[model samples]
Target: MKKILLGTICLMAMAACKNEPEKSTQAVVAGESTKAPGPVEFADQKYIDMGKASLAKFASGDIDGWVSGMANDVVLRWSSGDSIKGKEAIAKYWKDRRMNMVDSIETSKEIWLPLNVHQPQSVESKGIWVLNWHQVHATYKNKQSLTFWVHLDMHYNSEGLIDEFIQYVDRSVINAAVAKKK
Candidate 1:
């Protein structure tokens, strides 16, 4: 009878402890902002389609179509710190390289992601941005071929036209390959 009574008392004590609220173990830092992160909108289909179409136009030698979606004051920047401003200048640059310099260019393993950034850092603008990654097989006019991965970020203005394009790639490898003679 004593053992039964002791077990019942232990169960009652455990039940009382279980009714207590849990205490947080996380330490609170002084002056730390408890702000929540900004909202992120993912996979806007139109931007993805536009990005894919732009790349397709470029690979198929349709320079005009590729540039048609760009804003009038578009800016294109390369990872090598080279930049081309204005839609006309960007078109000219692409024409010269695609028509005269490159014989054939093909893209594989392409990925496109579109996002609307509700809030961004000070250096970034809040708008639609499309991110692309692809493996390119490019043949120079000199018959030299190179296959490399490329990353590009295209920022679109409110009118759904691309205003900023940033291309990230190793320019040295491309320059060396282009400089090679047949």
Candidate 2:
């Protein structure tokens, strides 16, 4: 009788242990263990398609088409310490450059490669960001050529338009190309 009671108690304890939920080893924000972090998500095909379309518009020298993807109050932050605010400002900036300096934009050798995209699941306030590695080849009106690599980050607004555009590049290459004319 005692042996039967002891075995029953041992079986109950084992069953209780098995019913307990397992804990995850993954890290979470604010030490909250209720939710485990998910794997990093890459840009979907839609984002890639949008990026390719925007690049195509740029390559074709369609300033209006390129600007169409941006929000009305878009902010452009360049690595060269230039900040352009508003869609109108961006349009004027590009128009000035196209009219004054650039002779043609070559897209045959240009490449815009999507590197990574991160959308934090825990952070609700943070928006999605995409990293694009670019290789731009352009020819100046003076027949001088410039080719450089640029890193671009784009933040999309809730309306699916690009709200913030940031570029990282070595401007010295462009400056040298311009200085050659002088």
Candidate 3:
């Protein structure tokens, strides 16, 4: 099942990028010139970089490094309808429950997509928002393993710190895995 899901995600990603225009070193604006100006950069590259780095740290079980990218007042909302506010509380929650329960986590696949919306308010926002699709393989301390998909919608503040993180995952899979161990 995990292999099937991973394969499907890979196909989807390939199909999504198939139709994209070939990137050139220069972006033509107002039909200026054929010569490229310079390498184009994504507007949200920094936020994406920070997010990827945080995920890498999490995958490597570096809880401290992962939490370091968050804002002091970061708000984290879990799919189980629990909300943790402030960096300290979030760290404690993870350390007590999550980090302790899960022996290790490995990301099988990740895709970062822009928030597709057309609104003036969204356009004028001070921060950038990204939706990340993550397929993770988690192993519990009891040696139980589960592969799950998580959707994370993260908002980065102007200082490039994650201010809001909304995680969507099916908790039943994890619950069942734990129940089977008992």
Sorting all predicted structures by TM-score, with the top scorer first, yields 1, 2, 3
TM-score of structure candidate 1: 0.80
Q: List the residue pairs that clash in candidate 3.
A: none
How many angstroms is residue 172 displaced in model 3 relative to the true structure, after the best TM-score fit? Answer: 2.4
Q: How many backbone clashes does candidate 3 have?
A: 0
Cα shift from native, residue 140, model 3 (Å)? 0.3
TM-score of each: 0.80, 0.69, 0.69
lDDT of 3 by residue, 1-182 (tens): 99999999999999988876777777678947775433321344656677788889878877788889899999998879989999999888777766568888889689986542223253233446777899999888777999989999887776778888889998888877866663
Model 3: weakest 10-residue lDDT segment is: 116-125
Rate residue 80 of model 3 by lDDT: 90
- TM-score, predicted candidate 2 vs. hidden true structure: 0.69
The residue ranges of model 1 lying beyond 4 angstroms of the native Cα positions read: 1-37
Choose 2 or 3, whichever is better by TM-score: 2
Maximum-TM-score candidate: 1
How many Å off is the CA of 134 in candidate 1? 0.2
**Against the true structure, what is every candidate's RMSD?**
7.5, 8.1, 17.8
lDDT (Cα) of model 3: 0.77
